[model samples]
Structures are given as structure tokens and as C-alpha cells.
Target: MNERHEHLGRLLTDAATRLGPGPPWLVLGTVPLDRPTAGSDAVAGGDELRRWVRRHVDVWPAPIGIAAEPPELHPDRTVFTPPGRPAGTYYCELHATGSALGAVQVGTLKESPSDGGEVWAIGEGALAWLTIALLRLLTSYAAHATGWGGAGVEARIIPAAGEGPVVPMEVWNHDGGAYGRAGVRRLATAGTARRTVDLASCLSPALTATARPLVLDLLRRFGLSESRHIDPAGVLRRSHFTGHDELIRTWADTIGVPSAP
Candidate 1:
């Protein structure tokens, strides 16, 4: 898979984990939403898309970043700002692929702004759940498409340029083939058990070690820990980062810098 596909997979996985398991929280294949029609120059034809997004989405109403269609959803381009954001703001991607509609993506837009606007901060709580949701959704889609089930998944926090450690997450492939390698039919089927464990360990340290705790804490606070599952309604109703102190510490520690612990 190219960088676009990899990022697409990443985005979907983020949505699935963060959104959690429930009604209206469906895992979908990669598709396009803006500039319906197919071609290599999908990203170029995003004027209409920008207008549409501004009309619908409440956050980031202004166009700060460029929008292009992902290569996977050729023909339908997306209008979005690059990733990164400020404390009070968020950005998302909207697209339709095949039969899928209104695939909303938040926070993958808003990279370092050229205009020098406020950048949003992705706290630990959001990062943790977002990582899992993305993995779960991507794994499900990959499994369904490849006809091979996923064994496990993982994630981590990595430093971004001029930013503190971010949740640079990845998922393990139970299959033996390297990720996105050409001529690999079933990505989840080519691996041996030894490789599987190693891959899982490498891919999911963030998920197991940190994200799980963050999620557990959030669920506990909402009196939903016993549910042992994500509540989409609750999340959608008021979606913002919950934990602050621990998140800041995680970012600091992950980056090997000293912050109030």
C-alpha cells in the first residue's frame, strides 16, 4: 500500500476505536466524498468539496488547509486541512466511497498552518481511543476484504516535528507478509506464530500499555466501564478530550522530556 492507503487505513482505524462499538458505528471501506467522478487528479478538483464541508461541519468552518481526494477513492476528492490542531478546535474529513457515505474524519487535517493559526492539541485520552478505534475498524475491513481474520493490534506515541510525542500508532499483521508489500494477496495470512507475536508487540505497545488505561479511566468516569464497550451516542454527544494531566505527562514522558509527573 502507498502512503495514502496507509493513512486511509490509519484514519478509519482511528474512527472505529474512538467511536467505539455500537449502532451507527459501522466499519467501512475507503471511499471518496467530494468531487464525485474518478481520476488521478482528484485532489485538484476540490473547490466544490470545500464549500460543502464548510456548510455542514460546525468546526473549522474556514478553509485553512488544502483538500485532495485520497488515491484509493479515486474520482471523489476530499476537502480537508492538513493534520494538527489547537486546544479549542478540530478538523475532519468527509467523503463517500462506493456505497459508504458521510465518512467523517477529525484531526487528520490541520498540520502546521502556513498562515500560522492556532494548532489543536490531541490529548492522551483522545489519542488512546482514536488509535484503538482506527485499528479495530481497519482490522475488520482488512479481514472482510482479505478473508483472513486479524489476530491482534497495537499502537504507540511518537514525536512529531516541533510537537511533543504523539500517538504514532501501528497495527500488527498476523499474516506473514510485510504490510503493503506488492503481490501480497492476504496481508493477515502470511505470518507464522513467532512473527505474529513479534509484530503484535511492536505494533501495539501504545494500545496495551497506555491507550487501554486512558480508555478505562474515561469509561469509568462515565459509569460505563461495566459496559466494557464504547458508547457511540455518549461520545458523539460531547466529543472532547477528557483527561488532561495524565495526557500531558504521557506526552512528556514519551518524548523523554520532564513535565510535572
Candidate 2:
């Protein structure tokens, strides 16, 4: 494996050892805010990704909220980690405002041991987990409407705190608010990679197969999808997070919970 990948693997293994057998807990990673955005593209470790998935799954029942605060530093607004712990864990929290738009928070990526600031560690996993949770929750709550015609979904990955290499994804349903909606979505997925969702699956079940093409065409106009040729009969095919139920369940095993809490 490459050095970056190898490093992430080792960190996750250590985290497993620290947590012991049974269920897994969230892991956070720190990144420098000043780091180049390009560096954020690095692939996260497999173990880290696994743990991250577990964390998000745990929050499935609760209203999924995405935040940028330090899990250890921000306890009340955060869920994954406790406060004043000084651990470099990912930040996970609910976007409780009820409004779909806000400034998604980000955590610090680089910390010096001498500085005693929280550095990246278990937090990275937490960030990743939170990313997916937000997506699922957004879809769950989205209003299913007709007559909009051709609304598409948009997703992107962004880095935070420098350590990023995290994903910043969004699902833009249609125009009149595509950018605005995307901004809110990014805020939801900030600090993790898996949060990017395939918007096609989140469509209202009431939509007929005949209308699927129109929705996709509209989505393309908003810059969310690549083509107007999307098939309504293939909505499931466009979903990026589907068919991974088993994988999600396995990941939860590492986090100590059977599934997202």
C-alpha cells in the first residue's frame, strides 16, 4: 500500500486495539486548515472508513445533523465524542436549525503535541460517519413533490481542517435553489467522504417511472447530474449508497453498536 494508505490502516488498527473487541467507537483525524485543497483528495484508510461508517449508522434514528465543531471540544452540539477530552476525534452533530441552509462547521486539522490541541485520530472516522448520516436524513425528510419536472442531485467532496482528505458532498434537487441547497448539503457532509449521495434514489416514491427522465433532465440543468438520459426505471442504479446494508452493519460492529444509534 502507499504510505498514506498504510498510515491510515495503522491508525485504525491502533484504534481497534484501544477500543478492544466487541463494538467499535468513532475515530477523528485532524487536518491543517492551511493545507492545500488538493491534498484533501488523498484516500482515507480502510479501517478508518469502516469506523466512520459505523458512527453515522448509529445516528440513523436521530435527526442527522452535520457540524464542524470538535467533538471533544463541543459536547452539547456534538454527539460522537465528549468534551474537554483533548482527543483528535472527528466532529459529529445534528443540524438542529430545521432550516436547510447554514454555515457547516469544520474542525482543526493540525495540532502540536506541545500545543496540547486536539489532533486527528478517531475524529476522522466520526467525520466520515456523520457525512453519510446527514445524507440519509436529508433524503428521509425531503418533501416529495410532483410537477417540478427533471430535478437532479449534485454531490461533491471537500476537505476540512487541513487533514480533510474528507468528502464535502451535496444533493441539489432542482433550480431556484440549486446552489443554496448544495451549500446546505455541503455543510451537512463537511468533514467526511461518504456523505455524497446519489440523489436519484431519494426521489419521491410517488413519482412514476415515466417522470424519472424529466426529473433527471432538470437535475442536469442544475449541474447535479451529467446527463438527461437518466432512466426513471433505473433510479436505483443512480443511487451511490445502496446495496451496502451488510457493509454498514459490519462497520457498526467495530463501533460497539449493532447499527447507527
Candidate 3:
């Protein structure tokens, strides 16, 4: 139950290569719960997990203006997107031991139908927003450790100590996780004329410069200050940060940060 994320950066890279991508248009993710007591009370059943997801999905995401509404579940777990279309079913698989919670993975059921286009064509804005939302959800549950892989993203978990860093809500707030995707895009466009990044082009490294910081910031805010960045071209950089004061020093050593730190 405690085993998760020992070789993060390299593992993710290899996954993207071998796995290719996650299923099209899926709100998929993993959360490693750090509950101390490994008792039957700690386990989450299907109904509990379904309710948990529904409650959180109501609050997080882009903003109230663009956030996903709570979903209506059918007996088969199919959701309301392009209703009657056999897109996919909702699912939650809990991995836990008697005293401690392992990982909780849920998929394909939290989002609403798109304004238009293919039911599976979830855009970059939704992708970025939901990504942050899922991380926040993990943090809310006091996850010992967590990371995500998208349709084109791959996350490799290197078996590490069952325990993870003492990440608190304060760390997430102070480090600016609340800024979310808007902050990511804003910071990325600081010195350039570009106002947005094309996340769909992720397979091409077209976003190495912008993508690096976005990914690194997620790691930092999640209390994972140490990781190795393996660029699409095969170059690598290892980063470590102990506190906010070292932010600049750390960025200079990160794969990408504003030139001035």
C-alpha cells in the first residue's frame, strides 16, 4: 500500500513511450491515501468512493463558470456526456490494506458534456484545470504521495519508502496551487508574444520550455521538491528545494524557469 513514486521522472517518460497515452477524454488519476490506521474503517467501498468523487467534483476545476457539474450515474456507470452514446463507464478501484489506504483510481465519470465537438474531444483548458483539481483532491485527502498521467502523459512510479513527505494544505496554498492553469499559462507567456500553449502537442516536446515549469511547479506545490527531469530530447536535470528562499536557486537548476528566476 505504501509503495509509490520512487523513480518519478524517468518512469513517466518511459510510460509515455510505451503506453502512448491514456484513453481519449478521460478524467483519470491516482491518489495514495496516507491514513495511519489500517483498519476496516479505513477502506473505501464503491458507494463511498462514488459519493466522495461527486462531492469534490462539484467544487474544484477551472472556476464556477467552467467547472464540471456533479454527474448522474447509470447502473452501468455510463455518464451523461453525449448521453446514450456508449463512450465509457465510470469506475473506482481502491487499493488498501487493513490499516492504511493505498491508491484510489477513478475514471471517465466526473465531467460534463462539451459545448460542441466529439464527446471525447476535451480541450486543453479542461485538461489543465482538471489536472490541478485532481491534485488538489489528492492533497485534500491527505495523500502521502501522488502524480498523474494523461492521455498523452505517462507517469512511472518508482517504488520508494511507503511513506511520503509531510505535505500540508498550507504548502499547496503558499506555493500557488490555487493559481492553477491560468497562472501556468500567464507565467509561461511572460516574456513571449505567445498567450497560450498547445498541450495536445505534448508528444512533440513543442512545449518543453513551457511544459517543464508547469510540471515542476506541480511537483513543488505537491511537496515533491526533488525529481529528475528527462526532456523529450533525452537530456536530464535533477532538482532539489528545501524551502521558499531557495526558490530562485532551485529554478536555476530546474529544467525551465523564467530566465531571471
Candidate 4:
């Protein structure tokens, strides 16, 4: 592994340990703002956001909301610990648009430690659901955002915070508004080496020895989301976050994964 890949492995492994027996999904993205939107209200997970997330992201802490201040040094976050399912807590930070804490590089090739401030650690959720949700969230933020950033969006699927198969992917915002300005900022995978297991794993004597990069590549089949982000689809449909159940179900075929019965 190169220095950069090795570095991200460490950062993600540590995050996994902190959020462990975890193989949680981490979705990272940013948008420029006219001004920071910090306040005493739901600066990040405001009611509109809550409704949007609930519809798109399964297993979201249904009442996700953020107080504009601490509990968390992070400016905006909503935390949830289900009754006895402590390991299944839903921890997310959308750092108020202008907060310094929100400034992160999203698994940049430079190898940064500036996350933890922006890591939204979901102790429980499905990868497909999270992937769909990330696209939904990024599209909304991009459509509404006042400006743009160099780094567009990144998503990582980590099998173990200790060490295991990891898959990372990124795409850029082309027009600043939405898709296909230059061309749809298509999703592409990135990692220290494309052979992720070749790098390392903390799993066991067996599993890590023979692991796959993860199902995230399936996300690329949709090109991170052409049906959802681009048109041919209508403007109302393109900008809206609904109408993605088919996408989620197409990629999600869970095994031993619990579901509401």
C-alpha cells in the first residue's frame, strides 16, 4: 500500500473501532454556502431535512434533529441510541454549513485526519440504502447550495474499523448546480490499490484472506445515480429525493440482515 492508502486505512480502522463491531458506511460530501447557517435551531437536521432523510435512508433515527450547539463540539448533529441496542446507535454530523469543524477532505489522496468532525457513524444501516441516501442528500444540497467545493462527494464501505476490506469512491460536481453540465460527475472508485484486500484486514485468519472489495461497485452500475440525478428525467423528478426505492431494492439483497417484521 502507498502512504496515502495506508493512511486512510488507519483513519477508517480507528473510526470502525470507535463505532465497532461495525462495518458501517461513511458518506462524505460538501457544498459552498453564501454564509454559515449556524443557529439555535435545527441547523443541520431541520424538519425538512428530517423528513427527507427518513424517506430515503432506512433505519435513520426517525427523530433526527440537531441543536445548533453542543453536546457535540461539532456544530450540528443528531445522536440516537436505540433502547438496548447501544451498538446500533445512529450518530451523524452535518456540521452547520459554515462551521470550521465541517471542513474535511473526504478521504483525499493527501491523507487527512480532519474527519471525526464530519464522520457520520451509523452503527447500523444497509449499504445500498446509504448509497442511495448519499446521492439524494448531495443532490439536494448541491441544488440549493450557494457555491461549490473542489472535492465533490466520497463514500466508503468499511468492513471493520479494526481492519478489513474497504471500498472508497468519489465524484465531482460538474455544473455547480446539477448533472451533465460538462458531463454528469460520474461515480468512480478510489483506494490505495484497487485490490483492497491486498492492503490489509483485521478480520480473522480466514475472512480477510479472501474478501471482496464490497458491493459498492454495484453503485457504479447506476453511475452513482443517473436515473436519480439526470434528465431525460423531469426537473421536479431530478431535484426531488423521492422515487428511489427501486434503486435501493435493486442493490440491496441482504443476508442475515435484520429487518422490521
Candidate 5:
């Protein structure tokens, strides 16, 4: 493997080891925040996404909120909102093309936190869910960077154990906030080589078994297929701290992912 691929693999493996075994948790990655014009739609979409997640994943920790700030930094106390259910708050930062969209971050909540080992367990689960969200967002961003067009980009997760075939959840951008059914037309185009490499680099093997299906289903939903040339282990590595690393580290620390020596 190339240096970047090897490095990311090591990091993921180390993270998995540090996290240990726990309940099957979903790492939903970050969803992209559309520009200010779509602000209200983004809010509705966030709420819908949060609610959909609550249904599929067990043990949601509370005080979940979205922030413009990175997860390592404390969000504005005044802006934090506890979920209707009781729990400590965890925040996920949203982005679009490397710029922070503070105005769009207002008033988004995920779930409330629980206590004790349960909190750690839940945090790990939340990390998985967040990971998925981030991957999807990154995929969309990469597609745009590669010159793909179209509004209404989204990724959906249906738990493996859940009753039906897991399909991509339709995300409404400028489509009047309507959720589309699975098997819809492609929203984002097939990822470019760079996009594929970045995705492979960021995704850990430990997560592949679960995350792979979600990704494929999303591609299918978008009317695209996985690129044949993409090597999950050959992508060039940059700093792991770029993109969603701060949030990943914040959650990893909470769940006890080992720090690099």
C-alpha cells in the first residue's frame, strides 16, 4: 500500500482497537449544509435526518446539536439545545467546500446523552453514524468539485437488521423539502478519481462491512455505481485531522480511541 493508505489504515485500526467491542453503533457522517438560500430547507432536512436516525439506531445520547464551530471547541452555550428527551449534548459541525456556515448551524439537535458506560457506548455508536454522514457529504462535495451538477443530494442509512432492503434516503435541497423514495434518479454523479481516493483513505476497514452497503446503496440511489479503479487502500494520505477529523477525534476521545504515539 502507498504511504497514505497505510497510514489511514493504521489510524483506523488503532481507533478500532482503542474503542474495543461495544454494541453495534452507526457512524452517520456529516450531511452538507446547502447555501444560505436553502437555510430553512436545511433546518427541516436536519430535523428529518435526526428523526430518521433515532428510529433505526438504538441508544441515542442527547443534548445533540449542530454547531458552526469544530467539535473540539465548545459551541456557544446560548445556542445549545437539549433534545426533548433528557441527555448531555453532542454537537456535529457542518461544512460546504471547506467554509464554515455558522448561520446555517443554528438550532439543529440530534439526540440527548445518557450516563456512565452507556454514554461511551452511545458516543461510539454516534461516531459510526457521524462517519456515514461525513462520507456522504464528502462524496457530494467531491462530485461537485469534479464538476457534477444538480441540487437535492442526500445519503440514507437503513440498519442491516432492519426489515427491508436498505436504500438511499432522498435528501431535499431545493426540491421543496420533499423526501424522495428509494431508486430515484441520480442526484450526484459518479465520483472522480480524487474523490474516490479521498473516500477510500478516510474509510476504515473496520467500518467497510457495514459502511460499504450504505455507500453502494447511495450510489445506486443516485443512479451511479462504484468506480472500478478505486482502491480502498491506495489513496494518498494527507493529515487525518483534515475535513471531519476534528469531530471524529472529539467523538473518538469520548469513546476512548487511542491517541497516536
Candidate 6:
């Protein structure tokens, strides 16, 4: 792998480490396996992609199992596992064929006991970490291919359940520094709101500052208050964000991190 690929891999690893461990998480993507035509640009693209996947696979955490799916599976096809009381899946679907890129879908799912608020928080953290990794990968890819990054890029988080109004948030990319949006389609549901908060926490510091008031405004609109005294880092360390508030808060605040709002 080249320096750019290696650097991106490190960023992904760092984010995963921050998230720690929770329910089994998986990272899946598609890469061309066929050899490229000799003396064609496809050759270079194929090589770059292969190297990138290699680095990512190498650094994947040992605890989280990798989910292997058939290449023919449609990107839009939903994969649901047996419901776990507080389990969820965070996924990022990237479409790339030949030398062109396509639309991306970044989302999360909460299994059984849909009212399980803790699942939403943990799942949102997973989504944010994955989204950041994807952003870094895209940023690097853009830089290497076009000598520029953060062009023609925008992102928004919508309710995974497709049950409510859509809230759109702007996305920015600055050499992979920080940029993204987190919104929800419905506010009436606690699960949806929790996911929305999870998504918002993934924003760049500047964007987060701009988005905070707006997010807080949305919470009030739903008669919901910002969930405080919950330890996001502890959610990473354990299965839920309820206990160990002081320690998690100390570590997060000292580190300038907040769980939601």
C-alpha cells in the first residue's frame, strides 16, 4: 500500500479503537478482484483499491467478526440478523465500478426491543466511526486522483426506519479533518432521536459547533431534552452508556468529547 492508503488505514483504526467494543461490528466493502487490462488506467485503479482493502483488513479489530457476503448481493438489499435485545448494525455502502464512484449509504440498525435507547447510542457511535473512515478514504481517493479533496461532497442522516420527516444536514470535508451531518426523519421515537444524536456527534468540531444549537432546537421541538450524564466512552467499554458517568465524563471532557448535543 502507498502512504496515502496507509495513512487512511491508521485513521480508521484510531476511530475503531475509540469506539472500543460493543455488539459484534463488521466492516464490508467491494473491490474489483479481476485483473485490469494491461497498460490501462483500470490497472492503476485496481492496484490502488487492492492495496487500500489490504491495509483496512489488516488493522480490523480482532474482536469484531467480519461478515462475508456474496459479491452479487445488491447494495440496496437489507441484511437483518436475529433480533438481539440491545444489538444493532452500522453499515456504509460504497459503490465503485471501474474508475468511477457512485452514491454512498451510511446507516445503522437497532434490533429487537426497538425501545432500547442504549442500543441506539452504541449503534450511532459505530455509524459515526464508520462514516469518518469512509470520509477519510474518499478524501484520500479524491486527493490522489484529482489533486483536491472535499469537492462535490455532501451528506445527511435520515431515519433508518423511514417513518418520519427528513432533516437534512450539510457535510464538509477538509483533508479529512472533520465534516459530516446527523439528522433524523422522526423525533417522536426515542430510538430515532438517539440515533440522531449519535449521528450529530460525528461532525467536525466547527460543524458540530454550528450544528449543536440546531440539534438542540430539534430536540425541544420533539419535547425531548439532551441526554446528559451518559458516558459515550463507557458505552464503548461496555454495552450501555448508563453507568460510570463520572469516569466516562472525565475522560470524555478532558478529551473534549461529548456524547450528544
* C-alpha local distance difference test of each model: 0.29, 0.29, 0.27, 0.30, 0.28, 0.29
Q: Write the per-residue lDDT of candidate 4 for residues 64-107, one digit (tens) a residue.
A: 22221233333343332233322233333343442111111122
Give each prediction's root-mean-square deviation over alpha carbons.
18.0, 19.4, 17.7, 17.0, 19.5, 14.2
For model 1, what is the error of residue 2's alpha carbon versus the real structure, in angstroms, after optimal superposition?
Answer: 24
Clash totals in order:
35, 42, 9, 3, 29, 0
Ranking by lDDT: 4, 6, 1, 2, 5, 3
Ranking by TM-score: 4, 6, 3, 1, 2, 5
TM-score, predicted candidate 6 vs. hidden true structure: 0.32
Model 5 TM-score relative to the real fold:
0.23
Q: List the residue pairs that clash in candidate 6.
A: none
Question: Residues 1-261, candidate 6, lDDT per residue (tens digit)?
Answer: 243334333333332332212332323222222222333232132334445533443332222211222122344222212233222333322233221121123333332232333222222333333333333333333333333212222222332233344332221111123222222322322221111122223223332232333333333433434412222232222222223334433433432334342
Runs off by more than 4 Å, candidate 1: 1-68, 72-122, 162-261
lDDT of 1 by residue, 204-238 (tens): 33323322433443323323232122232112111
User: Quick one: best TM-score, which candidate?
Assistant: 4
How far does residue 166 in candidate 6 sit from its true spot (Å)? 13
Model 4, which residues run further than 4 Å from truth? 1-18, 24-26, 31-52, 55-90, 98-129, 138-151, 162-261
Worst 10 residues of 4 by lDDT: 98-107
- How does model 2 score by TM-score? 0.25
Candidate 6 regions exceeding 4 Å error are 1-43, 57-122, 158-261
True-structure RMSD for candidate 4: 17.0
Enumerate residue pairs that collide in model 4: 13-161, 16-161, 163-202
Each model's TM-score, in the order given?
0.25, 0.25, 0.30, 0.35, 0.23, 0.32
**lDDT of candidate 5 over 1-261, digit per residue (tens):** 244334333322322222212122122222222223422222222444344323322221222344322233223112212343211222222332311111101111122122111111112122223444344333333333222322222222221122333222221111123322222342212111111233322333332333444445444443444411112432212123224344544443443223221
